[model samples]
Target: MPRIHFIAIGGNVMHQLAITLARKGYQITGSDDEIFEPALSNLQSAGLLPKELGWYPLKITSNLDAVVVGMHAREDNPELVQAKTLNIPIYSFPEFIFNESRNKLRVVIGGSHGKTTTTAMVMHVLQQQSFQFDYLVGAQLNGFEHSVQLTDVPVIVCEGDEYPASALDKRPKFHFLFPNIAVITGIAWDHINVFPTFEIYKAQFEIFISKIEPKGTLIYNAADDVLKALVKKQPRNDIQYIPYALPQHDVKEGITFITIERITVPLKIFGNHNLYNLHAAYWVCKTLGIDARSFLTNIQSFTGASKRLEVLLQTNDVTVFRDFAHAPSKVKATIEAVKQQYPLRHLTAVFELHTYSSLSTTFFKEYKGVFNMADSCAVFYAEHALAIKKMPPINEVLLKQCIAQPGLSVFHTKADLQNWILQQPKEYTNILLMSSGNFDGLDINELKNNFIHL
Candidate 1:
């Protein structure tokens, strides 16, 4: 078993990867300055928890087989510096993943949104078909035991993130994977902190297409004009370009039924965006040799990736959903899904401006009209979140004006937000709590329970 040390292992994917490698009997050691739950509890349980928080150069030694780097680790991170000085091989998590799967077939799912859902869909259908494969998905899925798997499996499915890989390796994570087959769900400008302009952001996807292995396939969303235009502009003679659209579907009695060939199968998941993701997954599975019938049969049982249109509570009177829809496109798509699913119900869309991109006034205007579908819109921002990101304070009046939604409410305090939510009309309503953050430690379960018996 090769010994690996992780720098900044407190990251969501990093800790999960460490735990996964440990389970496979590899010697895993990791360190981070600050660790948060789920990662903390998970590392503790695995007996790989750092004895002390923060970087220690001593952890990286000449004897170590390799040092795996996480996104948050800076170029000058002491452990990283130590590893370099000791002549130890260093790999970013994605780079390491590519190294492990070099001999295997790799499928990379890349896009501004729905990376997790699309990747999870591919994994779910492939597993149900009893095909041997490995995977790296962004979110927790119902059946998947871990976010990453590294083995001798002949195939691997990866969520190709556009975020910069690490401080030293500034390329997008997906660039390292060098996929044999790739999926680009769509393009929506995001991560304003990194790629400041939309064109700059779109350029990343262009580069991703260029990275596909020769004669490999590129499955993309033909419905996305920007993505389609970009994909079409890139003239790759060796690559097979397959475009997918939302498969014909019907929503009856609040249930979405997808039409596959002559068969119409009911789906646990909803939304046009989700349908788009499923279509991409379908093409991937088809490329891997799974028939349409088997793919549709397995996809019917996919509840969805965690926090994407996830239901917190459901009563005849009220339905509460918590989603990780912090971006403008995602927020709009999620709201559309809920309102369309429960058109008759009064929809209250509650959003938390949690990410640096969302909180920064630089891109705040992008969220305008995203909440238009909701009957009532509520926006929350925690002061601490702003402080942590070191962004200037956002003016609530300006935010409201920017969103331009009728009767939209903005709350800075969790208490005020909770009160606003609880005071909402309970009967025949759908409340969607959308954010990338957990409302700054807001008790979601308790909030959901409050509405259950009301």
Candidate 2:
């Protein structure tokens, strides 16, 4: 096994990759400026946590077999500089993953949203059918012990991210994976810091479609008008385009069910967006030799990918959920999903301005009426987060005006949010928390425990 050094290894998937490699008997070591919870604990549990915080150029010795750079590291990072100077084989995780699976049949799930869940859905059904495959998902999916798995396998499923691969690479991660089968959940403008304009953000997907392996199959969401137009705009006669729409599904008393082949199968997940994602998975599985009925039968057990509409607590009276939805489109979709599922309940939605895009004053306007579906909505953006990101303080009035929700409440402090959540009516209210980041260290399980007896 090679000695791999991870530069800025505290990232969600980076840490998991380090763990997987170390378990495979590779000598793995990692360093980061600061490591956060989950990643911090996970690395320590794997005995791979760096002994010190921050970059150490000295650690990038000439003997190191390779230097794996994470997106968190800057181009001029001291460790990266050292690795470059030493001529160490440098690669981003995506680049490395693609290289490792070059000989495998790759299924890359790309889009602005729903990549994680859709990839999880495909992986779940494949595993259930006893298929041997590798995968790189963005989140910690239930039943899967790790997020990145690389080995001698014929098939590799990847959650293709549009974020820049690495500071050094400067290309979207998905661009690195030339897939035999590609899925686009939908195109939504996001990562405002990188792709500043929606057109520029979307152009990456166009490139992605062009990069698909010759004669590759493209499964996309036909419901997204922008994406639909993009697919139609391109005349790639070499590839097969398979468009998927939301399947026939109905919600019955907070439970969602989908129909396939004249048989009804109940689902643990909700949302029209999720139903569309399921269809994306359904098509991919179908292309990979899994029958439609088999895909549906096994998908019944896939509760969901973690933090993407994950149910935190549920009781007779109160139901609490948290999701990794920070973008305007995602927030709108999540709010609608929860509200539609529990239409009878008084929905109290809480959102955190966690991403740089969500915190931007310009991007705030994109959130117009996003939370309008919720009975009560509150937005939380930590002043500390703004200061750390070096972003200008958000104008509270402008934010409220942008959201356009008359009943919306804005909170800068977590204590205020905690208090607000505690005060929401217990018996008839369904609390939904949406953010890619933890609400500035708010404990969801603890919050759920408070309403356990209700």
Candidate 3:
């Protein structure tokens, strides 16, 4: 058995990948500065948790067969330096994934907004057909035990992240996959820290397109102007390009009907964005030669990815949704989706500025007008977030002004925000809490219970 050590393995993806590898019979050991819940417990249960909390150079021994570096570790980590000195093989998380699935047909899903949902949709269809394939998705789906799954299956479906692999690897994670079938859901400027300019960000997608294997397929979102332009400019002749758009749909009484092959299918998941995601999934499945009707049937039951506009509490007149939508484009799309679904209801969109981009003073201006559709808008930020990120304090007034929604409100503390939420009259109101992080450890279930009981 190969002995592998994970450096900074307590991250959401890193921890899950470590556990998956350990389950595959690889002897996995990992370390992190501060291991949090779920990850800590999961690693401990698997007996892969490090004996110590912090990094130690001595842990990088010659006995280890390979070292997997996680994004959580800095470039100058002492353990990383020690590994380099020992001339041990080091792999980024994506590099290792590519190495594992080299012999399989790799289907990589990329984009800014709907990659998770699209990937989940494809996986759902494949699972319904009883097709055996490995996968690594970002968000948790309904039937999957872990977000990252590895097997000896013939195909691997991955949610391709455009983010940097690790401190040592500046290349985007998706660039290394060399996919046989690739999907770009859409391109919206994100990760301001990595790609500061929109042009630089778009270039990464181009690189991803170039990485497709010869005679492979490039599935793209035709509705996105940026992606469309990129596809048109691709000089690769060996690749086949497939374009997808929102399927024909009608909404009545908060339910969506998708028209596939002249047959209207009722869908539990609604919204134009989701419809587009479904269409993208259809094309991917079709590329793999799955019947269209069967794919649609399987997708009808996929509620959604965890926290992607997931409803936490619902009553006859009030609904509370929690979403992982911190990026500006995602926030706008989510707000529009909820408002479009419940046209008669007054939407109260509340967002926590949690990401480095959302919290940065330089990038706050990009979030302007994202919440214009909301009847009432509130932006929340925590002081500790700024301190920990080592960023300068953002002025609440500045954030509100930049967002520029009339009557926009901003809060720095969770207590005041929670009180405000509780006081709102519950008639025909939709409450959307959007963030990538918990709002300073607010109990979402408790909030939901209080709303339902009231």
Index of the highest-lDDT prediction: 1
The per-model lDDT (C-alpha) reads 0.91, 0.90, 0.89
Task: Kindly report which residue pairs in candidate 2 clash with one another.
Answer: none
Give candidate 3 regions above 4 Å deviation.
Answer: none
Clashing pairs in 1: none
Off by over 4 Å in 2: 44-47, 51-58, 61-65, 443-446, 452-454
Cα error of candidate 3 at position 442, Å: 2.8
- Report, for all candidates in order, the number of backbone clashes: 0, 0, 0
Query: Per-residue lDDT of 176-257 in model 2, one digit per residue for the tens?
Result: 9999999999998999899989999989999999999998999989889999999988869999999888788887877898
- Which residue pairs in candidate 3 collide? none
lDDT of each residue in 251-364, candidate 1, tens digit only: 988899999777789999999999999999999999999999999999999999999988889898988888999999999999998888889999999999998789988687
Model 3, C-alpha of 227: deviation from truth (Å): 1.3
For model 1, where is the 10-residue window of minimal lDDT? 144-153
TM-score of 2: 0.94
Question: Candidate 3 on 91-147: residue-level lDDT in tens?
Answer: 999999999999999999999889999999999999999989999998778888888
